[model samples]
Target chain A: MLEDGNLVFAACIILMTAATYFTRAGGLFIISKITPPPRISAFLNHVPASILVAIIVPSLAGKGPAEFISAAITAAAAVFTRNLILSLLTGLICISTLRAFVF
Target chain B: MKTSTNKSPGTRVVFSGKGIAEGFLKCIPLGIGVFAYGIVFGVLAVQAGMTPLQAQIMSLTVFAGASQLMALELWADHLPVLALTATVFAVNLRHLLMGAAMRDWLVRLPPSKTYFSLFFLTDESWALSVREMASGRKDAGFFLGSGLCIYVFWNSATGLGATMSSLVDRYFRDPSVLGLDFAFTAVFLSLLIFFWKGKSQLPVWLIAGIVAWLFFLVLPGKWYIILGGLAGGIVGALRDA
Candidate 1:
């Protein structure tokens, strides 16, 4: 509750830990008791990928048009190649080189 | 093979330990970047009038990089304590679902153990755990193995990073020269590729990208994350439906 630097850190630890626990606990508690509907299960299955796109796309939005276009290219390469590391490295090289040279 | 067959409860302990070791080892490059990033957080904590011990404790306890950064930003802006508190809570709201998913594994542990382990949960840990859990990992010990590895290294690295930043900077000079800044986007893109599944999901992904860009332009604050996620989820579901 206090704003002292140390206290703030302590508070964050306690608050974040508690919040994370409650969310997980809610799912574990409820899901264990009942069989989730097929629809719900399907939704849960997609959640992680949805969340990933959720987090990534916004950050990419802040870039320039060329960066955006190249990133799209990079994403396409990733899908086509199905190589995680390669795709990411390609995106990094694309964006960083663009940043270093173009802008 | 014989080592893998050692049928002792200590086997669980040993496996957990080995898993932790491997996890830590795998995390080295990523960990180094995290350490560099931690320095920035540490400096901000110290600047905000926190003692070194307090700064270490933040890394020890809270341990979420984004949440910590947001909290520091809010503090610097002189936001009310309540507002700062609320902002921290809101920023970390996703972890609640993460925690809930891990609850069954948690239920097996003693109250004290579960209580303590919960303290170390973060986005990275949760991401790692969810990956393991979704693949139907039955052993609570596997998570303990992975999660503990993450917890120890993260805190130690942050504490050490914060403690050494001044001296490290003087010796190393221009830490940004290391190119650690782009690691997150790189990591995300890597994970994204790994999770893409197949061509069926491509349109959904594209729609998600477009929605996120539109939301970022139209919305303020971090709503882009939420809006983009919901928008993407709906599109994904509708296509499958």
Candidate 2:
């Protein structure tokens, strides 16, 4: 159970790579068939944004109020700027700076 | 010669050098983030003990950011191989939906283009293609062009990031803790903001997001994305009704 132990690490990478390929390949294969219907198409259209927010929200869980504030500030900057790199840079600067001062 | 004898300005614009250049230019902002993050993944994979060749191949082949990161994290956690595999599969399941969405757009493209476009099927490229498709650009070349540009940047950056990682031991020492991961989250949010056009869709997305978080909190594995996606999807569909 040693973290970064060589055997464990390699196995993790290989397994993760295999599993991810399986899913992505599944999509590539399925795209060749089964044209999505209107209702289904509409439903799938909503899936990406939904999946995105779902991914982001859980990431913010368990943070202190300060980190949350930092994230919120970052999110606002991101929204206003519509610049992904800028938003992330601002968030990083804000969080690291806050950690330096607050902790 | 009759067919090529005359073409309208509009047709020329559609297939113009300007159109292709414009597509590549549009992808620049998104490309920088993708390349930087790709480097982080490459470095992390190497740090996790894969040889450089192994790490590079994984990035080249798999090409999904979150899955690579999650795998490295799980490896660090010492999770069993089966569990790690399962997590990777679960996290990437959403791409199936993404792929299916692109099918209609790709069905008519030549087989080579269809296959090549798959390489650029990350979240950003998908979002760009989806938005273009939504705007009624049924010509698959737009997607093909956009996907090709992003693909080039992604793979090249992966190589550069991996190479860069080897030079600066300190830089390669830790994952760019907040660097690429934050970009991952930021890219996802940007997609959400773009897709949410008005206040009408706002509440539904918010609820879906909350539900995703709750599931992620409670669920044992990566299935939370699927759960959150379904819950949010159903809510949004109902609200649209």
Every model's TM-score: 0.72, 0.70
Alpha-carbon RMSD to native, per candidate = 5.8, 6.4
Cand. 1 TM to true fold: 0.72
lDDT of 1 by residue, A2-99 (tens): 55654655555576555544643444456545666665555555555665676677766565764575567677877687654466567667666766
Q: Write the per-residue lDDT of candidate 2 for residues A16-99, one digit (tens) a residue.
A: 666665664466566566665556666666776677777778877776765676677777876798765577677767766666
lDDT (C-alpha, whole model) for all candidates:
0.58, 0.64
- Please write out the lDDT profile of model 2 over residues B27-111, one tens digit for every residue: 6667776767677766766677656666676676666777777767755444477876777678777766666666555555455
Best by TM-score: 1
Docking quality level of the chain pair in candidate 1: acceptable
Clashing pairs in 2: none
How far residue B174's Cα lies from its native spot in candidate 2, in Å, is 4.6
Tens digits of per-residue lDDT for model 1, B11-76? 231224454454455444455556666777776676665566766776665666776777776665
